[model samples]
Target chain A: MSESRNVSIRVPVLARVEGEGALDLVIEQGDIKELRLRIFEPPRFFEKFLEGRHYAEVPDFVARICGICPVAYQVTAAQALETLFEIDIGPWARAMRRVFYCGEWIQSHSLHIHLLAAPDFFGCGNAIELAQIAPEEVRRGLRLQALGNELMELFGARSVHPVGVRVGGFHAAPPPERIHAMREKLAAALPEAEALVRWTAGIALPPDAQEFVSVALRHPVDYAIEHGEIAASDGLLIEAAAYPEHFVEHHEPHSTALFSSYQGRPYLVGPLARLNLNRDRLPDDVQALLAETGFALPSGNVFQSMLARAVEILLALREALRLLADYHAPASPWVDATPRAGVAVGGTEAPRGLLWHRYEIDTDGLVRNARIVPPTAQNQARIEADLRLSLLNFGLDHADDALRLHCEKVIRNYDPCISCATHFLRLNVSR
Target chain B: MSANASVRPRVAVHKFSSCDGCQLAFLNLGEDLLTLASRVDLVHFAEAGPLDADAEVDVAFVEGSVSTPEDLERIQRIRARSRVLVAIGACAVSGGIQGLRNGADSASWVARIYDHPEAIASLEHSTPIATHVAVDFELWGCPVTGTQVLGVVNALLLGVSPRDNADKVCTECKRQGYPCVLVARGIPCMGPVTRAGCGALCPGLGRDCYGCFGPAESANTDALSAQFARLGLDTQAIARRFQSINSQAPMFRQAADKARAAGNE
Candidate 1:
């Protein structure tokens, strides 16, 4: 392979991540000339469709934005509306909400680790091949994933697009028996999740450390999941209300999805970023497990994101167990929310990363406008940035197939949810 | 033990313009997913790491609606290669929630969202997979569950025709011994006319059915709307109830139109 020869790689459809996307990369004179993570997942116009819908419907409506993390959208939307209505969801609703969100983190992280990203390191084409090679590990991953769905179902009725969330609180609370059963299941899965942390930490990850800013939610008393103020590795902290002033989303020619940049630069989100920013918030045992695995926090290596996801799964399990320890059905699940005219903004840590939402409502409770900034879209710029640096480091002269695989691995490592990313609205679109 | 891979039914899960919830039904199968992979040849499921989109398969589970120009061409190619094309979830069956744009001004909606609307390759109307290509079977839900998807797959693998349950959600509620939210709590429920599959999920959760499963066979949506009106729902509210999730389904479409027209009168 001569360095002078130009190479072009086009992946028509990127497999294994959420929604439709493709990659186009070009190397000129052995220097990376162009790289575009072309997210062709068609715009769903969710923001536009949200207009005129009542406040109560926002949770279910937004849940459709991303199936992999529906609870993220539900919780974020509910929080936004609750803030505007000035309603207190109370301690019971608050605790249960965290448990519900834990279910999402566990299932989503386990799925990504086992089925999506793990096979890449082992030279397997898919999880099926990986299962043939390591059946027990794969089975354990599926069991943990199923347990997450079960936890979600215990409160949500069904996990995929759960119907339990309402504006003020939940539509119904799981009885004490169901809660007890789930607590036991969560307890049983903790060991399995801990094992997952060890297993991912041992994988042969490519040592291609790069410079990037990490961003996630930061709760004062907890490792933010359901609620938090937005924080960055660069030491910037702000509420969801100040998000638009700091973060900007713009459309690129190659992608239908919007790319988000903070302070005019690409920053990282998701499990690795969360772990990087909030490592001290972890419970002692979970922290001890990470320490035992010899996985350092604030790791610059992007490939260790698999390990990061596994660690989060262990943390989520612990969080769910602690929350469900003392379960009592609330006499009323939701308090009545009155219609009001105001703007609402909320930020929460979705399984992937920070999911922020804003809504404006009329006195009749009809939504006048809506905007959602999903984690994947925020990471789009960062993904392309990583691709350029990673491929250059891995050598552009490698075979096209090798480059494509590496590109897919890099993108999948982010666990980019293209569906959630493509729903952005550009306020100044030229007619 | 499963049969030889070469002879087993080949399966591929495809996505278009959806949240990936329906395709996730395969992954959500949890342990059964591994069993399914062993029983079938999963040559092209992108979420699980296989990316042979053009591979010929015995059964193709298509999720999401045809919302883009590329989507239109891709669905046709899939239909050609697949021996049995199954459209899964509300997106594939009746255009899902994204199909809400169908009744509204789609171009204006695009202009409102994207800076370069011309750069966005989107069809004006978000449509079901059936609208673009021949579909063998349709599974309805905002997101079709793992059990529903697996039942269809198992039936196809066994060479038996899968059952299509057209009964309404009310029937499922009756069988489950769950009280009706509409009659008991004065909530405007869509169970009387919405299809059964969720096993009356929302009703069991003490909430009104929002019709994620689309319309039942010969559903009297007009009567349901009348009932909703009597329950103190405004015309717009009644219309919105039918126009959600499965807005593009024929019965729901007509019901929504009628509700809006009645309001105008």
Candidate 2:
């Protein structure tokens, strides 16, 4: 009778990452039947509301989409606007943009590595429990997170929705003294960031690797963050403007998020995807650091996502230090953005993954239309795919408590921007 | 894991429809977060842990705004369990950025982005908690600063009335000795009407204030709107100023309505 019992599970995962959504899973006689990572995140209808908004308001408008990755939205929207106007932000402003992005990568990734993901790995309930178990480690993680916040603070006043980001460039530049001051602070946190890499490298995550299709942006000279070509592990290269031509979004009835597919197959994005596509672009020290951990690139284990985030934190620190060394005020805070009617695309790597933005501006520079593909929405299919595969491997017929914890572990690995995905999930199990 | 007799106020944080930024204010506290934990029993924080949301608590810090049926029910449930339901950030106090949708056609807003409008379950408007249930007090900011969050938390723990300065951003800007971005640089700013506590950060950076903190204690919004016109901002542009973060607040909403009326004229 026990063997014949049907399995039904619901884990109401509140936007543990700052959004709201829930999960529904059904199992029929050991075979997983239905799994819907439903994101009923109250439809803010961001893209719809963006219509009729001015180009100058793009940064402010999009930044409101995700508080965690506001820089990603601001920069992506700004770059798209710049593309339409056919204006260069100047070399100084361009380099400065990378520095600003580095802050986001550091802060956002560190938050995940320490607060969100580590608890699962440590077999604890949350970061606080993990803190009790490993006080020093938790302290280091918090300090690293604070440094990331400080990095953003140096550029954008505060780490949340920075007002400094404008269309063509920043609203203003930080003084050299402030940059030097932040550089000194980052220097203090640098060693701990490397330790974060090594520590996550040693975490005895279960050896679960599978075939994966990874996607990220590729730049000519630097580790891609601010702007790049859309590159995939499948050897697909599409101009940023031609993103819609290759990728398609499908609205699943079960989930509010639009599931994106590459040629109608599940694919991966975020830190792991970025590391796979742009490993060579990483600095020599970072490359050596990755080698030192014996963690080969192009990994399929989603858990190494934690490792990938840690490595990105180190890279962000190094780049920030270099950029801040000789910081100066730009001749102008922004280029003259005389918006003309045109359609353009801009893609940047948010801490979680690729942030794609496209805008059609009218003659008056008001947004005629906008399409934003946040990384979490792109990774929704992948998250469910991983859940389906992992649950089956973990034996879905197991007790509800054991199965639910494992499922939450797998979900946290992606750091799903649940706020960005129509997001909380509550767990309910029924036969 | 500790018992209820721990002599600490059981505090829980809840979210509605806004970004997790305001709640992050607590975690972003770094070492201070631990200090805060020592002072208060953090029973349920979705972003922080997997605790029970229905757990009875002495003080409940609520973020975000009511934008869906679930949010409506959830706020009611949280209010029942919480002794003091304190609203945090603009989302709780003024319906946040999503509140901009209040005057617009909700159906069109959904139809604009999603192909399947029927799938959306959002309420017609994103509204602050005060509209649905009684709120003990509100801390206003797009994302309230760590200082404000900690101040409120301490006040709750000590049973004191939370102190919000109720000053305008301009007062802080003046204290910081930064020349007015609007006066000196001709940049249209909402500093005159926006609240303090964000440290007048925008004006300090030579940028205009976008009113992340909602309206000041007693804002002269009409006078400021006229000042914006004198600075050469068109009615539409001036309306956009009051239309970002706190557009649903009574004062900001009135100012935006006036500018929009003028724009139509």
Candidate 3:
């Protein structure tokens, strides 16, 4: 009979991240062990609560699912219901959607970069501490983040959980002057954002590489922020419509979020995956910024995700500028969307990663069924896998430091938005 | 509040059950953030970076609702650590949109999302931070605006009383010279009763206010209810409109209660 050894780890509070979560790893006999990334955040039951609510109420209801990427929820929910109603918002409306989405990416990615990711590079507990050491860098990062929020406010009417988004389009398009004002800010922000990319790329990254099943949207003409077909590094190509058929979510005992597997395998998404898969789609300036930072495609060092986010920030700024330059106010801010009985799915690349919404609507346009799969939920399994692989190499005696850094790295890789993944909020860790 | 105080005030942002939007709002201050950071000690902000070794806080900006026992205890600790604790956003101020479940069974809500309900432990309802600890101020919104957040920070820095108006959204609408969507299109709106911080956003976009900003100070519920009734909306629909988004807020809750009571009568 073989003797067994027990290994356990508990993180009292997970730091430098949004929402709340804890990790518990139980190792027996040194070979491997039980790892639980317990998502004990209380269930708000957004899908259940969404039942019988009018289709128009979806943007507000779903937007509550994530504070970080409320626009993502609003866009995906609006898109799903709009599809059910067969409402085709014109190019101008679509451009507005792109603009709104760009705000979310800027806000969310910048949060990840300065507040969440940079602390690891500087050996600080959080961004606030990093500010003490390098105040200018932190300030530049915050300004860039604010610029994103400005866009959200200009287009969506509020930075978080905007009320202007509707099924067909915005409640009202911004005035030309407001768009121009935002353009001026983006112009100022572009250089700072590019500098951030260069600065972040120079950070010493962890050398471990994994053959990632990177997943992201691929648009033919530009870097895919709002609209595109879904593509993965493993040669799998599918339209957004085929998402349900290609990927499935499984309920795991350790998490409230459903772990998603693409064709029965764990996959990676978000800025790193997007940058690697769609580098060709990025603008020349953004591509050049990537080159200047020495960032290359298919780089599996998860730490470079911060750099990838910076690269995307550059792309978002350029895209925002381009959209502003060609801005044309829609004849009507929104089209009348009459809900019909149907089941529909809407998929979009949220700042964090792929956000999906599926809904069944009745003839009266009330939601009969609602299922939202956020990027964090999809990344849960991969996060645990990273923790398991990373920590297994490091022994239990150094568990606290190893586990903390390991957990932070794993979380940074996914850029998990726990708020979007759970309906209610709480973070619990039980070993 | 001394202008020439020797030590700069320490500000820390905390999270419970939230979207991290309120903290993001602080980050949204941009270049102003550098000035703010230099002016004060940013002690602990998890969404921005790492947690401080010490838990002491001078002014704590707390986001999210108290949705668990741990949150309840953490709020108490934060209050003990801070001289001023400001509850930011709908979640922290009024239990947020998730508070829609306050009237429902939390166990059932859990079962709806999870396969094994027994594995999870949670409170029956999501409640605001003030329910657990004394809050010096509350910023209302589904997600509070960056400008308002900066205003609070600036007020605290300047040692001046933070002036947050509790006017109705209608005031902003009238100021902006926008047409009334509810009166013109018969769309149900909460603008007359909703708080004013959002600058009449939905109405500006040609839509009725959905009241993400909670209710105005001393809003006339009876007037709005009668007006909604005059608009030919049913009692149940009126109740739902009042109960949504800001349902847990006092003024909105009172209005919803009045509507329900009126229906019962």
Model 1 agreement with the true structure over A1-431: per-residue lDDT tens digits: 99887888998888888887899998898788889999888889999889999888889899999898999999999989999999999999999999999999989988998988998888998888899998889999999889888889988988888999999899999989888878888888888988888888889877798998999999898998998899999999999899888888888878988888988999999999999999999998888888899888888878889999999999999999998887889989999999789999999999989998889899999999998889999999999999988887888888888989999999999999998899877655243
Model 1 misplacement above 4 A = A428-431
Count of clashes, each model: 1, 20, 7
From the highest lDDT down, the ranking of the candidates is 1, 2, 3
Q: Estimate every model's Cα lDDT from 0 to 1.
A: 0.90, 0.84, 0.78
Docking quality level of the chain pair in candidate 1: high
Give the runs in model 2 whose Cα sits over 4 Å from its true position: A1-5, A423-431, B1-5
Lowest lDDT block of 10, candidate 1 chain A: A422-431
**Residue-level error in angstroms, candidate 1, position A91:** 0.6
Task: Please give, for residues A92-168, the per-residue lDDT of candidate 3 as tens digits.
Answer: 88887887888888887887888777887787876666888988888788877778877898877778777788888
Give the Cα-based TM-score of candidate 3 against the true structure. 0.90
User: Considering every candidate listed, which one attains the maximal DockQ?
Assistant: 1
TM-score of every model versus the real structure: 0.98, 0.96, 0.90
What TM-score would you report for chain A in candidate 2? 0.95
Error of 2 at A209 (Å): 1.4
Q: How do these models rank on DockQ, best leading? A: 1, 2, 3
Scored by TM-score, the top model is 1
